[model samples]
Target chain A: MDNTNEKLGVGLLYNASLPEYLEHNIEQVDYIEIIPDMFWSDEGRNAYPRFVDLPQWRHQLNWMAKQVPLVAHNIGMSLGTLNYFDKGYIQFMKEMNESYRFRWHSDHLSFIKLPTKGPHDHNAGIAIPVPYDKDYLAMLREKISFITEQIELPFLIENNVYFVEYPDQDYSETDFINQLVSTNDQANILLDIHNLYANSVNHKLKARQYIDELRMDKVVEMHIAGGNEMGGMYMDSHAGPCPDEVWELLDYAVSKAPNLRGITFEFHESYFPLLRFDGLNKQIEMAKAIWNKYTLQPYYHELA
Target chain B: MNSPDFQLAFATLIASPQLCKQAIADEPSVFDQFALTEKEKTRLRSVLRQKGMSICCSLYRMNRITPLYTQLTQTATLLGDELITLAEEFWESYPDSSLQFKEEVLAFGQFLLAKLEVGTLKFPYLQEILRLELAINELSYTPAIIEKTVHFDYDIVAILLAMDRGTLQTERLQKVQVAYKVYLEEQTLKLALL
Candidate 1:
């Protein structure tokens, strides 16, 4: 395959336990997404205690940056809290960005920590859902601006899965997203295709129409994954193979978003047994075939 | 105690003290909102005043007595009924044949039944309750009837029952009991051995 003709790339979100050279397997894929938080802590069994310090991880991450663009997906920026953003966290992220020099950085657009009457709750790191309202939008804009100021890189926000019940809100999901993008002209979006599909299935909405209505020009990346069904709802389980609906939605979204930079395959080791890697490879082939079919020749050549 | 409009008056008294007092002092137009007849409203106001006074006196001493005593009593009764049902199900599912294994199984069942009476077992208590039942299920297994017999080897069955009880007591039940303040750690420890 002509490297230039491959405008799209398949890449794994780097897992620390996986040998660094595992990147070679999906090397044919265009770009790799590295989760900075995974490297932030040196506690896990397979994790390199000095992964952030190691030249190979840094050099290889940067090499991956040159060979194929690298994007930073973060897990710790609690964007939805009333409390001030963690300056230490922002500083750490700045240091990492300086070391690897990623194309962009994205985090979930939901709160993880809250103002409690006790010690800052560290265990409350799970992404929490926020109501779509004017007040919430204002809070999100301030947080996003703060992050953008610290990183100097374009900030992207990914939509999240909400498991708990929330009181009725005035705005719909599309309206909420539209307002967020419009408020921050510099903001980019990471559209998790499976998350959108899961939300549509759980909430009973037209998934394709939700994608159709989005400001696609603002979308820079897409995420696809599998979910487990729990308590009459599908938990965004990230544990299995992508459903056909999600793949079809991805194809439709690619056609819609002309500026989509890359697609990431997010796999969790805990649920690795449930996934069919062969099926995932076939999906990638399907995505590339669709990209070839729809992408205009001039843009394709320019990417080449 | 048997006032025609007692329910309406009681609801009003519980909801708003100011409204209840006004209603007692002089029937108000808001009483009309309750859709009570003139006689019924009078009867309701009289009974509400009596009940409200009694409640105030009860509350003054309620702290000295056991809080939620009525609720605890009802819960214990319901749990006891559930335990009996579970015990009956276990017996029906596994008819006793061996004297030693049967006694062991019945002893475990009795332990659970005792715990249920204490009102310490948490919701979705079936899994733990069933483990005790399964341990007793050994009596149902007979080695001589090999052609159509349930396997209940001593080590395998004992290990499984131990594992199940350990998970139930330590992992599932303890986490819920602590999280929801359903039972104290001391109380849970006492029940665990059972």
Candidate 2:
């Protein structure tokens, strides 16, 4: 749905290498979300090999920013951890933000580490779902505040796909998220559609109803992807195209997300072939058709 | 052929519906091999005989079949050496043999190589397949012949066979093999330069 006043943007997370992705596909979409870790190199603190140096990355990012608004979707910033935030990572992210001049940055509202004295478990540096409890909420607010203060850009927190059941959770996922957003006024929410879909499928909840209850005003961006059904659980596998159900949810989300700045299409290289440009073209066409059917005004910037 | 350990190990490996589909796809008779215990075999067979191969096939298809392929390659590599050594000695003794005789010998070599590669003629399970392939190549023919004709080496060939049979395990290996196969396919494009 192309709303002239609202920022209706189509995004691909970290698909910069594929020429067709940038030249062919992204041309049709609006705004691209780059995972800074993918481009980071060993040279400088946040040196990304893809960009070579800060100056080069700046030029490329600026160029992309000029084409359409650029947003940084980070995977490394473990927001829900009990441990202190990585100062090196924070500094690097700040530097990249300054260099790229991103619209806004967001990370998963999950823990990637535990407070330990020895070397951190670098291997398990994956975004893990946090227990939906008040204790966690208190810790999370402090972390979000610290991040927002360091980086002037609006810090957005994303909902994660939790596999294991939480026994000690004091509130529902929605309540926890709503509380976090309310406490941290500057913080926005990155509504990952697939994670929502997965949680609903696994936990047996209505996906739309969950979206209906979401604090949509705080949502700065949205993530959509495909999932794999395993052990009766729908794992968020970004290997294939988004299913019809997820698309329907996105349509519902668009109406709900009043302050939604952008919508990101998350796909990983491992499952890139399943999308096959032709198949992806059809999906994009479907998305466009849906957008056209819903929104009354078709803005030129919406296409950009 | 029917042993408790073999049945237990094989049954455990193919316990998952996805794993059973892959095992059956690779070797249709693999299910029959487990016929020693009808109860266990029937349970495994029912999973495979389901209406939709969606869940099992998708899981198998998504996972990289490289480790299984690697295991097959290792077997072939070792067998290739034995076959080459035997063939060379036979050929050297009877250098002026007829075409029929030559064909017979070559057929025997291929058969032995195939059987060994399939993990039937086993000693080194999966880990030593590569080393055995190299050893066989070294023992079997001249370096020039191997360098010029053996583009895949024993390890690569074994992997390809395992992939074809759908017996490969481990997702990471499958991803690597898929990329490697794509790389192999791209080599044909390079031939245009010639």
Give all TM-scores, in the order shown.
Answer: 0.54, 0.57
TM-score of structure candidate 2: 0.57
Which runs in model 1 stand beyond 4 Å of their true positions? A1-8, A20-24, A42-67, A115-120, A274-280, A296-304, B1-194
Residue pairs whose backbone atoms clash in candidate 1: A9-A30, A10-A29, A10-A30
> Which lDDT values do the candidates have, in the order given?
0.55, 0.57
TM-score of chain B of 1: 0.26
**Model 1 Cα displacement at A67 (Å)?**
5.4
TM-score of only chain B in every candidate structure: 0.26, 0.21
DockQ of each: 0.02, 0.03
Q: How does chain A of every candidate compare to the true chain A by TM-score?
A: 0.82, 0.84
What would the per-residue lDDT of candidate 2 be over residues A1-304, giving only the tens digit for each residue? 2232346566667654444456655677767788776453322223343123333344455666667666888776666655457766787788887766777888887754333332322212134466676767887898888888888887888987755444435778888898898977678899998999887887677788788777887887888888887766677878678988889898888766656677777876667677777766666676666555544344422532
> For model 2, what is the alpha-carbon lDDT of residue A55?
34
The count of residue-pair clashes in candidate 2 stands at 11
